[model samples]
Target: MSQSPAPARRRRGNARGEQTRSVLLAAAVRAFADRGFHGTSTRDIALAADMSPAVMYAHYATKEDLLFELSLDGHRSVQVLLDAEVGRHASNTDRLRAAASCFGQWHAEFHTQARVVQYELNALTAEHLAEVTVLRRAIQGLFGDLIRAGVDEGVFQVADAEMTAMSLTSLGIDVARWYRPTGAWTPEQIGHHHGRLALRAVGVAD
Candidate 1:
């Protein structure tokens, strides 16, 4: 009788596959960050991954697939981080402080991926764009919730919670565009500063 493959062998194959996909993703983020999505090609990503075009194709059917994956992962990761950060504090002031710091520092730490996530949405197919949009909206909603909470508690004075939320998010997202490790401020410093600024922006004394 024929038998199925060993569990260990299948596990090894799965691990290898995941590893390859990770390498490809790193390479893609770098490429897309340096060269916008339209300017990038599968061959470029394959070379950056140090793998052949065929291997890259085996993992990602199209360049858009890689981008969609990156965007989805980036947005989801940010949302989760913000959620955890905000949940850690009892007060809206503390929650905004943590959330802004986390958001800003994350962009500096993963600026390449952040850049692609923020700047490459136009290149995605409509179906992919719609999917990515849902994740983006969820992230925005997190910030909106925090701003609204602050307003409700009389901790934050803002004209419009929704617009204030968008502005707050933009402050962190823009960091990815120009953040450099060699800069005077480290990621932590930037984060701390952003935390203070966020409070001040929300009309809190900080």
Candidate 2:
């Protein structure tokens, strides 16, 4: 299947209201990424969104609520992307290449949101964390399945499919930590680079 652009998070009904919610979410992503969730206040997010705290509250009941939505969207975006990519290719190597490339590129393109999603798990309510963990596990499962398929094909020599899958995921997710638009590589370039690296990581020559 062809990929769809990541959908904007929707809530509270109506186009205008949804627009406001999206704006607030973007602001919250910036704040949480810049100042760590515990260090940033709702007022900071509201101000960043050019709204009063009360208006921000109207959209999100709590700061953690905003984080939950962001985290949920971020994880869901990755899962949907990986699912589509995994389905598009028949061979295990092709699946791994597409998954690793898109995963790395996503982190680079949406670094701020990715940063919050990757690092703010501790700040989410336990209930919210559980929900996000489900998505995380589904994503990890895709990588594990791909690695196992490669091993079964005699194309990958990993001793532990699960551990190799996690390491591959870590390589992609870590892109959000240090990526800069000013850097030499574009997201697509970095993504393909990661794709080649992933092939090697799985014991396939690029």
Candidate 3:
């Protein structure tokens, strides 16, 4: 027999718990991005979320858990974009453009989270750092494959696939550090601009 579903109150509680977790995550991302992980405290995160420290603790076991969640989330987002773009595009040049645009757009929109993931990763424990490092490597591998495809297809002329990928990733990731939404360019515009720049960097004719 099928077991009964959770009670209404229990379901509501679960939803509320998820909402609280998201709030804490956003708060933690902002705090860590602004204050550095070593400087930000649980109370600071709680106040940023407009929730008490006890409430924040109810959702996350520790600050390390929050950092891990943010790191994993950022890595997963990049991986998702890479998987979708690579699966959908056929032309090597188009694949590279799609990947670069998607990456740039993500950094522009989620600058705070991106900054935390990129800069504050060193604050995690060795075990957590190892896990995050693996995820980061997987994301880099996707881009490296795209670079190799571009070279193999003769669409791009590059000296080294690994170095080219690193340069491309850095170009996109650095947008998070200085990009401003109120600036002259929208995220889409910035993505397109950087997409062209990335193509040019790899010797793809515009």
- The most accurate candidate by lDDT is 2
| lDDT (10s digit) by residue, model 1, range 21-104 | 888988998999888998999999999999999999888899998998888888777877788788889989999999889888
Task: Give the Å error, residue 180, model 3.
Answer: 1.3
User: In candidate 2, what are the lDDT values of residues 1-206, reduced to their tens digit?
Assistant: 23433653566588988889988988998899889999999999999999999999888999999998888888988898888777898989999999999998988988888988998899988999999899888888888999998999898989899998899899999999999889998999989998998899889987
Alpha-carbon TM-score of each model against the true structure: 0.91, 0.94, 0.89
Candidate 2 lDDT score at position 169: 93
How many residue pairs clash in model 3? 0
Clashes of each: 0, 0, 0
Model 1 residue 149 distance off true place after TM-score fit, in angstroms: 1.4
- lDDT per prediction? 0.84, 0.88, 0.81
User: RMSD in angstroms, all models?
Assistant: 7.7, 2.0, 6.8
Better of 2 and 3 by TM-score: 2
CA displacement after TM-score superposition, residue 3 of candidate 1 (Å): 42
Q: Candidate 1 at residue 20, lDDT?
A: 94
Query: Where in model 1 is the C-alpha error above 4 Å?
Result: 1-13
Worst 10 residues of 1 by lDDT: 1-10
Looking at model 2, report the run of 10 residues with the lowest lDDT sum. Answer: 1-10
Report the Cα lDDT for residue 125, model 2.
88
Model 3 ranges with Cα > 4 A deviation:
1-13
